[model samples]
Target chain A: MFGLIGRMRASPGKRDELVALLLDGTEAMPGCLSYVVARDPVDADTIWITEVWTDEQSHKASLDLPRVQATIAKARPIIAGFDSQTRTEPVGGVGL
Target chain B: MFGLIGRMRASPGKRDELVALLLDGTEAMPGCLSYVVARDPVDADTIWITEVWTDEQSHKASLDLPRVQATIAKARPIIAGFDSQTRTEPVGGVGL
Candidate 1:
């Protein structure tokens, strides 16, 4: 499976709004096995997204998905910067 | 829910071994909603563990579990160092 783990810094005081945008419309993602949005405990403005996809192609394809594109556009303003991004290969584990 | 995302660096050539140790016996962990072990695509010796638990107490209690403790003991030598560890509050997602 393919995985993408990323940390994003939201504009100050906009973390919750950013998170809401992320969680919205995720139910329709085709290749998504798991898509979790989490808040950084220490840094209130930081958010972490953990995604598991069936394959890399599916992940790449999702970017062109209208809902995803729209969400990205909506979130662009509140997104201060990406702190880290890691692509991963998930071998085996629960929830996969 | 409580979440913990961590990056661990394994001793050279021991990434697979460390990953096996982490995946072992996770089925029995109570209150664990999701537990995924992934390998960093760029770094052969780096692994990321993404976990979601029912609560912080459940996560803390899991450390003392016999299977978990044994795995920790076995993994200690091969685990070079932790690159990052972040505690999180998981609001909503597919896996959970």
Candidate 2:
């Protein structure tokens, strides 16, 4: 399975808004197995997104979905910058 | 929910061993919702562990489990070092 783990920093005071937009955008992806949005416990403006997909191609294709594109456009303003990003190969786990 | 996201580096040529040990140790976790082990695509010796639990106490308590303790002891020798660790509050997601 393909996985992506990343840390994103929201614009000051907009973390919750950013998370809402992210969760709202997750409704209809075809190959997504798990998509989790979490808030940094200490850093209020930081968020972490963990995603598991059936394959790399599925994850890439999701970006072209109209809903995803719209969500990106809507969230762009509130997103400050991404801190770290890692692509992974999931072998086995509870969620998989 | 409580969440933990971290990156761990295994001893040279021991990444798969570490992954196997971790997966083996996952059974019987009481409040764990998800525990995913993924390998870094770019770095052969690195791993990312993403976990979601019902609460912080459940996570803390898990360390005392005999199986978990054994896994930790077994894995300690092959674990090179931990790179990053983050505590998170998981609000909503596909798995949880």
Candidate 3:
């Protein structure tokens, strides 16, 4: 399986709004095993997203979907910037 | 629950060894809900670690444990540096 761990900073007080957009975007995401959006307890403006997909291709494909594209368009302005993003190959896990 | 998402870059060619140590370190960790270590598919020397604990205090306490201290000591030299770390509050998920 493929995994993605990304840290995104919301613009000022837009953290909750960004999280809502993220949670909304997860709907009907094909090939998604798990997609979690969590709040950064220490940094109010930052959020962490952890995703598991069937494969690298599936993840890439999702980016092109209309739903995803629309979500990104909506979330672009609210996003301050991405701090870090790492692509990972998941070995195994309990939830997966 | 508390969550930790961290990215670590290993010394050149030591990614696998570091991953081994991380996996070994998970044994008998009290209050640990989930601990997953994954290889970076794009970057050979990087690894992503996603951890969940009962609470923030439990996560902090794990750092002081003998086993954890020993693991940190053993793994320190192999680690190149940490790229990013975000402390998160997990709302709900499939695994936990």
What's every prediction's RMSD, in angstroms?
A: 1.5, 1.3, 3.6
In model 2, state the lDDT of residue A47.
Answer: 96
Where is model 2 more than 4 Å wrong at Cα?
A: none
Clash pairs, candidate 3, are none
Question: If you assessed candidate 3 against the hidden native complex, which CAPRI class would it receive?
Answer: acceptable
Q: Write the per-residue lDDT of candidate 2 for residues B1-96, one digit (tens) a residue.
A: 999988999999999999999999987798998899999989999999999999999999999999999999999999999998889899877766
**Candidate 3 per-residue C-alpha lDDT over B1-96 given as tens digits, one digit per residue, 9 for 90 to 100:** 898888899999999999988887766778887777888888999888888788988888989989889999999999999998867887654345
Tens digits of per-residue lDDT for model 1, A1-96: 999889899999999999999999576778888899999988989999999999999889989999989999999999999999888888777777
Clashes in predicted model 1: 0
Among these predicted structures, which one has the highest DockQ?
2
Chain A TM-score, candidate 3? 0.95
True contacts kept of 1: 0.78
Highest-scoring model, lDDT:
2
Candidate 1 lDDT tens digits, B1-96: 999888899999999999999999576888888899999999999998999999999889999999999999999999999998888899887767
Q: Candidate 2, overall lDDT?
A: 0.92
Weakest 10 consecutive residues of candidate 3 chain A by summed lDDT: A87-96
The CA lDDT at B50 in model 1 is: 92
RMSD in angstroms between candidate 3 and the native structure over all alpha carbons: 3.6
